[model samples]
Target: MNEAAGDGSSFSSKVIGIVFIILLLDLLGFTLILPLLPSILDHYAQAGDVTYQSLQSVVDWFRKAVGIPMEKKYNSVLFGGLIGSLFSLLQFLSSPVTGALSDRHGRRPLLILTTVGLAASYAVWAVSRSFIMFLLFRVIGGICKGNVSLCTAIVADLPCPKARNRGMAMIGVAFSLGFTVGPLMGAYFAVSSKTTGNVFYETPALLALTFSVIDIFVIWMMLPETLPKVIKGSSSHGGDSMDLLSPVSLFHFTAVTRTKEPPSKERMQKLQVLGLVYFCYLFLFSGLEFTLSFLTHQRFKFTSMQQGKMFFFVGVIMALIQGGYARRIKPGQHIRAVYMAIMMLIPAFILIGLSWNIAMLYIGLALYSFAAAIVVPCLSTLVADHGSANQKGTVMGILRSLGALARAFGPVVSSSVYWIAGAQTCFLITSASFVIPLFLLSKAQRSKEE
Candidate 1:
């Protein structure tokens, strides 16, 4: 809320639009690989790659030890979650470094560096022959996943604090559209080769690589450095910034609501509270998202195509909200929007956990999807409004990096719980997790009043 407003320091609409494209393309590359990687493993296994040799050995041992069959599709789904967790883990480790680097240097150079690296990683993926080679590409891709955080930081830097959510909504629209189309495109390429007995496995990666190349060009040409001259040299700590390496520093919510700065107490507390609440919410939501396919398969026997359709539907709803409704909502109303969305989570979880029919399942999905769509821009607006000018990149990165950390661990833990307990129990526990955020949100309100 302490953001300074002026036209002279504002970013151009063109730069924001380009940032949107960059985020879209980044998600596009990710989604392209996500749905298909498990199936791709079958190819790698058949090829007798040493990595596949090791992985198949583990899979065989697990099946034998547990006396349970891990069918091709089931194995694909489980391995897919593990792979996603790995990517998120890498993103968590790298995001703060990227954000801090952006602060010390500038956003544009970091954006360009990551974008180009991502494109090259995709290129490696396209040409990959062995399972180790594929993992290598994924490792590189994970390291470059800091673009979105940097782009969010870039959006936060624009002149008007209140309008930051609108910019984030535009980025969200790009994300929705990418989510809608990327997997479909990857599927299309994948299906063309799926019937060939593992001969056409590279098609999807090749296409994703192509899109990444375009992203790199766009970043180099149109994206401007949004870091203002005044803020460029603000971070004076030189070699091996100690705070950057400190785990305590990483977990301090939003940089110590404990800071003794007289003028910053309220602002820091708002961010600290919101950041913690949002991180918990994201962790639960991600767990639900990852485990849903298992739930549907058990309850409805849904195929891969059917699951893809479900995600496509969620993406459409998000795109509509972010592009239309979200942009129209006034700044003062963002908190109300966040609260309304949070309330929807209760019924969303209950309906999902208790659903016995397709109608109930989709209805639950719709409610949850709508809630998530609205929350993203609202949270973005809140963080940007409160972030210190010199520390925006670091703050934004830490906020999102924690979410990345949750996403990394959420899937594995959720899936393990689902197996040990059951879908209903898992959903109910996730629903109970909402109590933390609700309590935090109430505290935020009281703090503001005080």
Candidate 2:
């Protein structure tokens, strides 16, 4: 029995190691386009493609409706925000369904399916010659991006909260490494294309496709079905009941209870509160994050290479914090760490908003990266601890879906604010908005205590 237990433990460890690599590769591909969004949009606009013009006309109408100006700088930023929001909106629609399906079928198959879909999306992107083609790429990519949520569910499947926390931290580290390296690679391609006169944006897209193919093969070969067969059979009925279109059903994880073993009221409340906190926080954070490249380009005239360097700095800081601090957080300490991280965001955004020079921006980003590194992992750990074994995938999916919803709207709203009011105002408002989630988090903690 002892030897058998040891083998199982060893296998779980191996699973986690592979999960880390998959996430790293997945995110590496996903983020390669981040630093290039502004340039890409500009290229489409200048190409005068019929689809680009059609979209531009609608944007023009919206600007007229809202009295936003026709400044070229703001135009690209707005387009970028729209593209970002579209990608996230698809994610919002798909995450819960994917999560519920994974609950029924198992994680390994879902991972493989999603990775394959992602590879197809990248292939489309590599050959995209028009704006509509690129838009289709985003659509497919977003629908398949539920891999991250599935990855988190895998962590929650581990034996204990401590193990789950460490696993979440590893996810964070993967994100850090991906973001750190991906943009740099993209920027290099961008520069090379300028000199080589290669097809614009083809190289980065091809590279992302390469990563997706590798990820698919890895999961097929190495990732065991983390969700057990018994759980899969039991949850099969509830899977079909998941209503993707109903926000209420999604947030409440209604399908999770169909198995006749609902979570306790207390646990349900905790999940609700955590989901809200995640949504609220990401709503604000993602908008600012999505716009950062545009802000730097407009304010500081940062080229693609410079934007890559900036993300590299942020990614390095985040990886260090996750590897050194976040992974070690004890079970009960998650809430406190969450509190501290959210509080840090207040100053971080303020400093970023107030930045006139690069030094001030980097200083704020240091704090931002620290907070970003810890909060999601800690919150995920807390949520994982609260979820019953059968409902882990559903719960994590609900949380990620909420985040996707926030991200879908956040960029559009923030970019509108940035376009009409300006970046300083947008940043200042977002800084103050952090209080909403913090207040909600504190209330949740108090209820948990009581």
Candidate 3:
């Protein structure tokens, strides 16, 4: 029995490591394409002088071979952005359903299925020859990928109440690390492709596909089933034996018999307040995403690579703050709130709105990113603290989906604002939106103590 316990510990560690590695690789692959997007579109649009007549001739020949219409080249970039947005939209749609499903069917199967789907999506992107094919692959990829939900469920399966906060913080760290490395690698690959005069679009796609394949293999070979089986003998004691399809009924049943802890109306109120806080948080976040890209492009005339580097900086600051400070800060301590408040007042976006140069832009961005990192992890931990173990995935999924919904409208909203008023006005509006969440968070904190 001791030997078996030891073996199980080893297996669990291995599975966790593999999951982390796969996430890193998947993120890296996505980042690689991002920096090159603008350039690739510009290339087909004939935006640059022919630095190499030979390369230009080859590009022309390839365009003709692919039967890309002359007028469609510039429009392809917009279509690509739409495809990517659609992918996120699909994720928003599927995540809660996937999380709820994992609650019933188990995390391991969903993880495997989603990983396989992600790989196939990458393959589709890698070999895509036309805008239609690209869009099709993006949609399919979005439908299949549920990494965030699956990972949240896995964390729920493993962590105890005391350790749950740390677990969530670690997940945030993993995200930051992935964001940091993925874009840097993508930029490097994009630069290399430019030198070789081959189309850069496919390189990142192929690299991402390869990583996904690796992820699939790692999961199949290294990961063990984490889901506990319901024993027939335990049914009399109120084990998980009910049909999972009826989630509402299952939740009600579980609430009734799964544990001895009585439901607290206060706890429910705290959760409601936390959920509102998260909703406001996501609203501001979506606005930032929409505003950042356009602001950088219009104000600094920054290239995609530059934009990616800015993202890399954000990732670095986020990882450091969340990994280093979030867990260490005492719960219910006023220090957390004070720190958050100070960070929020950094005037990053305000600076960005007024920046005349890249240096100032970077400084502003860094301040904003640092504040975001600190606040987001704290919010995540707060949610986890307020939720039951069985409901963690659902809560996280709901939070993420709300953020996605915000993001879905963000681009259009920002674009419209920029068109009508300008980038400065857009940023100013977004900056003010942050205040709404700050107020809500304060309310949440007060409610929690009460």
* Top lDDT prediction, candidate number: 2
lDDT of 3 by residue, 5-123 (tens): 22244544554565567666667765666555555545544643333233445545655786755533223333333444576677767665565556556666777888788888888
List candidate 2 segments past 4 Å from native: 1-7, 236-242
- Model 2 over residues 1-450: C-alpha lDDT tens digits? 011122256766776898999999999999889888888988888889899898888888988897766776788877888888999989988888888888878888888999999999999999998899999999999999988999999888876545566678888899889989999898888788768887658899999999999999899887777776667756646345445547787667566566557777877777778888888989999977998999998898999999999999999999999888888887677778888998898888888888999999999999999988988878877777665677788778878888899999999999988888888999999999999999988888887532
Q: Model 3, stretches more than 4 Å misplaced? A: 1-16, 40-85, 231-263, 333-346, 448-450
lDDT for model 2, please.
0.84
User: Where does model 1 exceed 4 Å of error?
Assistant: 1-11, 41-78, 195-201, 238-242, 245-247, 253-263, 294-303, 353-356
Ranking by TM-score: 2, 1, 3
TM-score of each predicted structure versus truth: 0.87, 0.96, 0.78
Q: Give the Cα error of residue 38 in candidate 3, in Å.
A: 3.4
lDDT per residue (tens digit) for residues 62-166 in model 1? 767887755544554455567668877888778877887887688888888887888888888878878788888878988888888898998888876544665
Error of 1 at 76 (Å): 4.9
Candidate 3 residue 205 C-alpha distance from true site, Å: 0.6
